[model samples]
Target: MKNKNLSYKFYVIMSLSIAAIPVVFIVLSYAMFFTHLGITSLFNIDNHFSGSVLTTYFYIVFFGILFGLMFIAAKYFKKIIHRINTMEQTVRKIAEDDAFPEKLAVIEESEDELNKLAASINTMIDRLRAKEMELSQMEDLKREYLKQLSHDINTPLNALNLELYLYSQNHNVSKEEVDVLYQKVDYISKLVNSISSEALFDIDNYYIFKEDISVHKSLKQTINKWSYLLNKNNIEYTIDVQKNLIWQANELWLDRLFENIISNIFKHSATNQIVITVGDTLIIKDYGVGFEIDRDHETTGLSVIKNICQKLNIQLDIESTNAGTAYRLSQE
Candidate 1:
């Protein structure tokens, strides 16, 4: 792979042609001298042929060599110009379309400066495409996350509003009711902080903040928080999570994971009895009309749940039928 620049090629051709000039001139001078002597001595001919005939021969030879050199230079330069033109057209096309192709055409046979430039452009296009894909995926994740976040925030907000309304009607708020309000307010505050700080969206920090958390405690607290809605709907539920069941997980994300699961149960599982067990595995079964898993169940809540489970290395399995729906989550 001998790469050559335009200057190097041009210099080589020009140097050879220029260096032949003195040699050609010296050879012509000797030929003219010997021809004049030989013709006059051997044939007794006149010396005027050197001026007329030999001079004409010299001019013809010199012009013929000049023409041959020019022809070679033209042919070589033509190929270089064509390559340059092709590169220019490619660049113009990309600029006009405002997009990069997957690859650039490179002349592998000739490792010239132009080929190297093309290879560089190809590398740059690959990097740009990768960056584009990353940004696009992030945008999609952000969009889905925001949808799920709004849904999660709405539950506590509605509870808080309902509690406030009840207090206004009675003109007296009980201690338990006040505690519930405080908890709802605290949860909403955390949601706001998480949103403002971009905690959930920050991939590097969110999944790394793990700790040992009691499964029973977290589930119990989530159920208590959503008690207002469950009671209003008259939905009966049972929990079998052991107090000793502790898992190493991201506490905030675990809370969110449970919250989304419960919220989905409340919204989609139109069942009266909900059973949750956390022993060797976690299972949330509802005795309601189940949904078809093969359908487009791309709800924000489910998306959030799946995202959390995937990032936390949790395996999720869903079973659904006309009899009921059950979601099982376990460590893998």
Candidate 2:
């Protein structure tokens, strides 16, 4: 894993070659003194002859050593240059999205800085991958919320329109029938307002209220508000909620949440007996044409159920079948 820089290696080699010049000159000087002044003087070689021969030998040795050193330096420099070129090409490949080399090429005794750079790059890539995953999850949550909102809002509005159209066609409609239609219209209006406020709360980070309230009272009031619609449709409903079950929640929001679900039953469910129980947990069960397990319900009630669960920090469970649909909301 050790990474070596080719440029640094080449610089060190060049410095060594330059320092060898003084050593080479000292070796030549010693050889000349021994051969001519010390030993060869005893054989009567004159200063002129000795000097001429010494100078000639010195020139020849200097030229041969210079050429040899130059050849060695050139060869080593060429190898360093080639390695640098290879590294440059590898960097370009990484930039173009090709994989980097697993390990940097380095001489056994050399120090390399490339290893540090590669490690840093790999760490950065890991962080980027984690951030990408987080963003993907948030995107998925957004899409699910939007889909639920659309279904919940549209179902009620469609039902209200049909009721209004039918009322308009009957010129001799009874006063009771007119009141029933008006109640249905009011339910639709409340549903639309609730959804709009929910969306605003999500975007602005501001919920409508914070109060210590009775959950039983909220449920009862919501049921009472929709009494006209239920009676008109001939739906048999019973409430078994205790009087003292209380919680910290927004009363208006809680009421709308219940209203949406009950209204949904009246619009889509084709049954008679509906039972709502309230205590530590709130449960709503309807003995109506139950929803199919494999089919998606078009009613906005389920969406409202999900919203309520999220807003209240409650655990909401739904169990539906051909027999009936049951909803349980519990504080956890």
Any idea how many clashes model 1 has?
0
Highest TM-score: give the candidate number: 1
Which segments of candidate 2 are over 4 A away from where they belong? 1-208, 297-300
RMSD of each: 11.1, 12.8
Per-residue lDDT of model 1, residues 1-332, tens digit only: 14566567768877888987887778877877787888798987665544666777787877787788789879977977887787777667666766775466786765478788778777877887789899879878877777677777777777777778678568876666666666767777666655644543556555356778887788888888888788889999889855367777877778788988888888887888889998888888999888877573675267778888887778899898899888998884
- Model 1: pairs clashing at backbone N, Cα or C within 3 Å: none
| Reference-based lDDT, each prediction | 0.77, 0.69
Ten contiguous residues minimizing lDDT sum, candidate 2 = 98-107
TM-score of every model versus the real structure: 0.55, 0.45
